[model samples]
Structure formats: structure tokens, C-alpha cells
Target chain A: MSHTTKEKSKLLARIRRLKGQMEAVERALEAEMPCGDILNLVASVRGAVNGLMGELIEDHIRMHVVDPGTETDSERAKGAADLIDVVRMYLK
Target chain B: MSHTTKEKSKLLARIRRLKGQMEAVERALEAEMPCGDILNLVASVRGAVNGLMGELIEDHIRMHVVDPGTETDSERAKGAADLIDVVRMYLK
Candidate 1:
């Protein structure tokens, strides 16, 4: 074990469990489940998933953006900016 | 910029947008927005947020848990298990 596992590592597991849920949602849809039930499943999955993301981004801020260990301040700012750009694309 | 923005790196950005949306939801709640509208906002945010997490976990598997560069099989397995435990806590 690397003993260096930080919050980022914890995020990995969060993603996996979420992946299972997402796949289940997909399966439900494929199985021709009722639209209302499928949508409800999608909605709940959405909240659980987003919570995971909020934790992750908060950690990124702690670990990289706001952390003094990141070296160049401008670089970090640019990194943050780039991250925002990427997210906007994903959301769009 | 680091020439190493793997999928997990992209996920960092995904989270920031979700954070913004979450804040918006909180503001809507504080403003006494209609429950239906607020819920819709929350639901959309959740999907976007969870999608980010799924990408992140997939990247982790590629980069750490399932990576050949990870060196130790037992260690990787432990990492995977620890991740599952942590995620279960978060989910509950």
C-alpha cells in the first residue's frame, strides 16, 4: 500500500459504486421499464452522483488549486481556469 | 499542461461546474423558489455531477487500480477494497 492515499484516492471508489448505479439505470431503461420509475431512478442517481462530484472538486481545491504546495500561483490559476473550461464543455 | 491530464484530471473540471449548480440550488431554496423548480434544478445537477464521478472512477481504474504500472497486485486490490468501503460510507 502506498500509504499516500489522499481524498483523491477515496474519490476513485466513489466513482466505481456510482458506475454500478449508472449501469443499472441503463439496464432498467434497456429492459423497457416504466418511464416514471426509470426517471425516478435517474433523479436519485443524479443526487448521489453530484454529491460525489462536490466532494471531489472540493478536494481538488484543497489538494491543488488552493494548496501552497502547487508551486506557481499563476499556473494554479490557469489550471483552475482550464478546469472551468472543461466543466462548461461537459455540462453543455 | 502537465502533459498528464488523464480522465481523472478532466473530472476535476467536471466537479467545479457541478459545484456552481449546487450553489444555485441552495440559493433557490433560500429564495423560496417553488419546490418543483428547485427539485428539477437539483435533479439536473445530480446527473451532471454523477457523470463526472463516473469518468473519474473509470480513470482511476485505468491509472491506479487496474494499471500495470501499479506494481503490486495485492496492493491494488486493497486499494480497490478501501475505495469500495469509503464509497459505501459516502453513499449512505
Candidate 2:
């Protein structure tokens, strides 16, 4: 079973919340809210999406790259760290 | 007229696309797709949300903080730059 499958419900919850946030953005735009308010909304959505990405990336690293707690492979650990850095840069 | 108002349609289009991306994530999960593929989907959604945030932040800075082309206040420009840095950090 994939780690994502194990965490399916949790991940879906986050996506559902994200959908709600996007809908809020839609409503805010429809109401013609000011740019500052809209920016705040967009920022919140961005933050939430970042949170989701962080979770998935962490799981991917732990399950696919290296399970740090059990693995003693220094090379794999280093590679996992580098992969994390790249993921951070890409998401950022 | 707020910059967001002027760019309302563009922003909405981006948000709509994000919604679709999120739906894809949900569907993928339901289908028990592998974590790697799911992560890629989430990453694309994150990218799109980041793009939306970038647009709103730029508009907010120009309209509220400092319109670089028109504003001559060095202090305000510096402040806007600092705010952008903080925003980028927060989103990251």
C-alpha cells in the first residue's frame, strides 16, 4: 500500500479545504472586494497549499527516498536531503 | 478602481483552473494512484496557486504599497520590497 493510500482520508480533507478556499476567492472576487483583502485571501490559500505539499513531500521522502529512522545509508540520507531542498525550491 | 477589479477575470480564470487541478487530486486519490503521481499533481496545483498569489501580491504592492513607475518615495519602495520578501518567505 502506498503511503498516500494510507493517508488518503487526511490528504483528501486538505484538498477539500483547499477547494473551499478557492470558492471563497471566487465569492470575494464576485463581491468586488478590495485588492488588499483579495491578496490576503490568496495568501491564505497559498499557505494551505504549501502545507499540503510539505506533507506529501515528507511522506514521499520517508517512504520512497529513505526512512531515516531505520535506514543507516548515509548516501541515501544525503540524497534525500538534497531532494528535499530541491522540492522546497520548486515549491517556493 | 482596484487593480484586482481590472484583473478580475484573469484571476478568476486562474482560480477555476486551480479548482480543476484540485479535483484531479481528489480523483487520483480515489483511484489509488501512486504517491509519486499524486505528488506531481499536488505540485502543479501548488504552482498554480503560487502564480495566483504572485499576481495578487504584485497588484496589491503596486496599488497599495508603491507603484514603482509613478511613485518617487524611496522609503515606500524599500518598504514594498521588504514586504515582498516577507510575502515570499511566508508563501514558501
Instruction: Judging by DockQ against the true structure, name the best candidate.
Output: 2
lDDT per residue for candidate 1 within B17-68, as digits (tens), equals: 5556656655654555544454466567665744544444444444544543
lDDT of 1 at B67: 48
The window of 10 residues in a row where model 1 chain B has the poorest summed lDDT is: B1-10
Q: Which residue pairs overlap in candidate 1's backbone? A: A46-B46
Candidate DockQ scores, in order? 0.04, 0.61
Best by TM-score: 2
Q: Give me the runs in candidate 2 sitting further than 4 Å from their true place.
A: A72-92, B69-92
lDDT per residue (tens digit) for residues A49-80 in model 1: 55654544544444544543454787776766
TM-score of each: 0.34, 0.75
Please provide, for model 2 over A1-91, each residue's C-alpha lDDT reduced to its tens digit, 9 standing for 90 to 100. 8989999898888899999999999999878898878888888888888878887987888887697556799887777777777777765
